[model samples]
Target: MLPLLLLLPLLWGGSLQEYPGYKLQIPELVTVQEGLCVIVFCEFFYPWHVSFTTDQLCIYWYWTGDNTYSNRLVATNCQNLVVKTETQGRFHLLGDPKTNNCSLSIRDARKSDTGIYEFRVWGQYVQYSYRTQLNLQVTDLTEKADIHILEPLQSGSPTNLTCSLPGSCDGGRPLTFSWMGDALNMLDPSTLQSSVLTLTPRPQDHGTYLTCQVKRRWPQVTTERTIRLNVSYPPQMLGSSCSWEAEGVHCSCFAQAWPAPFLHWWIGDRLVEGNSSDASFSVTSSSIGPWTKSSLSLSMELTSVLRLCCEAWNDHGNQSVTVLLLPGKSASRAEVALGALGGAGTMALLSLCLCLTFFFIVKARRKQAAERPGGMDDEDPVMGTVTWSCRQKPWPESTPAQQSHSGDTPPSREEQDVHYASLSFHGMKPQKSKDEEATSTTEYTEIKTSK
Candidate 1:
């Protein structure tokens, strides 16, 4: 960059003042940095015939005080002050007197040097004093712009960032504003001398450094200010899907959020174990984005169902997705449906057997009632009722009586083998009481044989 002092003429040409008779012109305003050099651009004219040799022409520059000129001589063409005094190293008159250029340059300007300065012309025994006030502010380059955020910044939302220059530094000379880092443009973002940058920041823009610069030609000042943006965003799915990894059944979940989202995995109804051999997993984190993404994979047994789930969350919000490899399948699900059906079938079979047994018992009672003598009524027989055809027992005959009574033989073998019983139906009457009925439910018979 060219020195500010060297550009003073070209930089502030439009503002240089001119006069009538002699036409002494110089920059109307100028400022020099402390410990730096500055130039007061000067040009003057006279009638061509009314020229003076170098000896007859003399040029002197003086510092007029802020309130009044104290005759403080800054530099003169006199060989002594130009080579001997403090002006030897600090001040110079670069413009030649014979050439009618009386530009004065100062080095190492100080705050006390802030005020008006003028050129004293001496030519052909005629001296002219053209007084012009140029306030020189010698300040360090440490002045910085103030950065302010108009509102809280949110991810995917527009925000206004204002860089206000020092209130004391605003000059009629428009201060050029610029941006250096983390911006879409280097030019001023606003119409004013300061800038108001409006942009919609993303989660990726958090912690991004933004630098603003303000430079003024007349003041010869440059100030830079930096600020970091903080952007907040909600958790969201990065890839929005999951699948088995190359090596094992691992699922990776991706999310974007501020302050990094917390992550966990769920399979079936149980929380998944991390970093274990049989379907264990792990979580990795990085600062590439504001959000966090987690991946979980469990080694599934051959009989294991292929359902996976992942949850990504933070203070703002949480999101989850379940990945199902096979339809209607999950880890550790029981076959309850098949078992329920089998139970129902077994109960039905037992009910059928009970019904058959009841039918057989009822049929047997009906048959016994039909076979009974005395021809029972068609009405349902009483369960304890009994009927018999034979009456009481018969008396035995004497041996001699049996031979005379016409017995061809004593008895046949079959007759001898026959058994006799004496039974009385009258004595065996039906009992209606519960105890007697229970006892009589079985049939009873009496028999006597020869033996």
Candidate 2:
């Protein structure tokens, strides 16, 4: 009866003190990704006892359903106790129970480690367990590594890039880091396995993928981050070529740069804009990726001299090149030598036709004047003139005295009035015209008339 009375008070006081000051301050749930880490902050309180000392406090974290001594323990501050083989180094008791701190730190968490956990405190003449439990949920690792660039990537300049995984701590399974990308192909092979990379960017590296991969050896977990590089660079002229197409010169110029450089066609100091057309020149431009191509087609006269230039520029810098649009006329060239030649030939042919027309007109007028009446003055002269009279008024019978002397009979008065006259005509051949033949003639005539 005496031993029964002594145990009753102890049992009654334990039950009454359980809910008053004994409590655990900790989150009810904790979530962590596999192969990552987490920290569970905790603090505990209990009724003070005269025989208990802070130095003798021992904290135990149990993984099994029951807190019995036979169950496996994940973490404990007592040096003589043993921890589970699976969580030997992974689970840590970071806080000292002497300060009422019962914090737990987990590293390289595994999926099998998900379960309810309880905190127990033991000391001389006192032993207690918090009814509040911590539930851990470890799911698939869906997080990726982070890549940080120190500054904007510029061509020909060295830059640093850092890679790190989120929720990773100093004391955990060592992670292996590696870099993968087209831009890293030219670098030393040994440098690709480091967490930090030194990169010298170029114009060709723009828009190329750069990947940072992180791997955990213990759990064989992998995570990666990919980013496209943006490298700023000056414009670089690739090449320029020209060909005669139909009636104009088709010229193409190529340039490459970051930020898609603006292309322009220059004739001396004039700026040729997009799809511009005039009497002598036309231009068109387009871009794809980092390359820009500009085309110029122009028809100019043969006598004209033109100098064609292709210029490209961006925020970084500028580039330019002079293009030859013709073969032999490279000294002072036009867009199309063939077009210019064709134009010159047409003008020459028209001039020739006009000259022939004028020549024929002069010859026709001279021929018509020669056929008219007074056009012969330079080729023919006038001949002698002859005069003749048909009427004879009594030649006076050869003068009446002459008739008497010649023993001519002078008839009566009427016969003497009717005198006879003789006239003679001599014809000389006149100058023949172009189409006629010359002739000669002579004739004599006798007439008698009464006055």
Against the hidden reference, what TM-scores do the models get?
0.37, 0.54
In model 2, where do residues sit more than 4 Å from their true spots? 1-27, 41-61, 65-89, 93-103, 120-129, 140-147, 207-215, 219-228, 242-250, 272-282, 297-305, 324-451
lDDT (Cα, tens digit) per residue for candidate 2, span 118-193: 8888776456666678898999888999999999998888999999999888877789999999999899989999
Winning candidate number (TM-score)? 2
lDDT of 1 by residue, 318-402 (tens): 5554444332222222443454355566546555764785588668868876676654544234223222111211123354545
The clash numbers for all candidates, in the given order, read 5, 0
| Candidate 1: regions farther than 4 A off | 1-138, 167-174, 180-194, 240-248, 269-293, 300-307, 327-451
Error of 1 at 413 (Å): 72
Error of 1 at 319 (Å): 3.9
Distance from true location, Cα of 257 in model 2, Å: 1.6
lDDT of 2 at 341: 68
